[model samples]
Target: MLANSSIDNAASQAKTMFGEELIWLFIFGDLCTFTLFFFIFGHARTNNSVLYHASQAKLNVHFGSINTLLLLSSSWFVVRAASAARKGLIQKCTRALAGAFILGAGFAVFKIIEYIDKANAGISFSTNDFFLFYYLLTGLHFIHLLTGLSLIAYFIYNFRANGITRQNHATFESGAIFWHMVDLLWIVIFPLLYLLP
Candidate 1:
């Protein structure tokens, strides 16, 4: 019995290590893709300085700022939720996760509004290279935000249905990690697309 138990533990450890390595591989690949896109975007802007500045001028800082704030705040909620779950506070963790999910949805709604207003004002993805990158990066970021939110919502639903147990910690941690990645990506995106001159 002891030998069998030891073998099972070793197998579990190996699986855990493999899973972590896979996650890191994904994260690195994502980072590399974004980096290459940013490099291309930077080169285009450098060559077409006038058009880039003009495009930047048309962006609504107010809307971008609000979305930034929402995402930042949501990141905090996700972090707290993950911490609470780790400490075995199920109710508090659930509320925090729910709050983060709602805030992410709010940001998505505001982005849609901003996009509509920009389109009404004759701005679009085809406007220029700068505007194209702006739309693409933010659109990609929004997709990540929504994906993270969906994961959190699913975890919450599953937890509620099954009752929170120690096993839920891994789900909570994964959701928090995903949320932080989205927030961190936006931190890079906001300055490049909105504030940088």
Candidate 2:
């Protein structure tokens, strides 16, 4: 009961945690779409557990694990950037944004390398059902990550030009929200794809 009250206090304290309502709506819509995608993948896997298990074995858990860490670190930097921005600390915000960008970009680089390795081994989306879903899911996620990185770059550009003003604070927060959604989606995807038995 005591822990529950502590959690409630923290939640109430963060009442202003959300940014624009439109961004939240868009995120909700995307999450809904992703839910359907995951459901389809689960259904397909259930129908062919043997093939799914074999194809899943082809994936490199190490790469997935490393990429997961990269994204989580990147999200942390984004949180710091948002915090620094709220505090009107321009230099700290800029550094945090840069750190976030680099870490997010690293995830992309590793993903590309993973794809190349699969190509070298003659695996393609057309190889099988599992491979198809893998490519489709990760590809869509890659697109979202790229979008998040672009937003980070945009936030950095604004900071360079405007030096962290109240006017742009909400915008930066919106970007952070989107970046977090990207990270959250991957958190689900990584385990669903890499670690699931």
* The candidate that achieves the highest lDDT relative to the unseen native structure: 2
Candidate 2 accuracy as lDDT: 0.88
- Per-model lDDT: 0.78, 0.88
The Cα error of candidate 1 at residue 78, in Å, is 0.5
TM-score of each: 0.87, 0.90
Candidate 2, residues 131-159: lDDT per residue as tens digits? 99899999999999999999999989988
Model 2: residues with Cα > 4 Å off, grouped in runs: 1-17
**What TM-score does candidate 1 get on C-alpha atoms?**
0.87
Error of 1 at 174 (Å): 1.8
Global Cα RMSD, each model? 4.9, 6.7
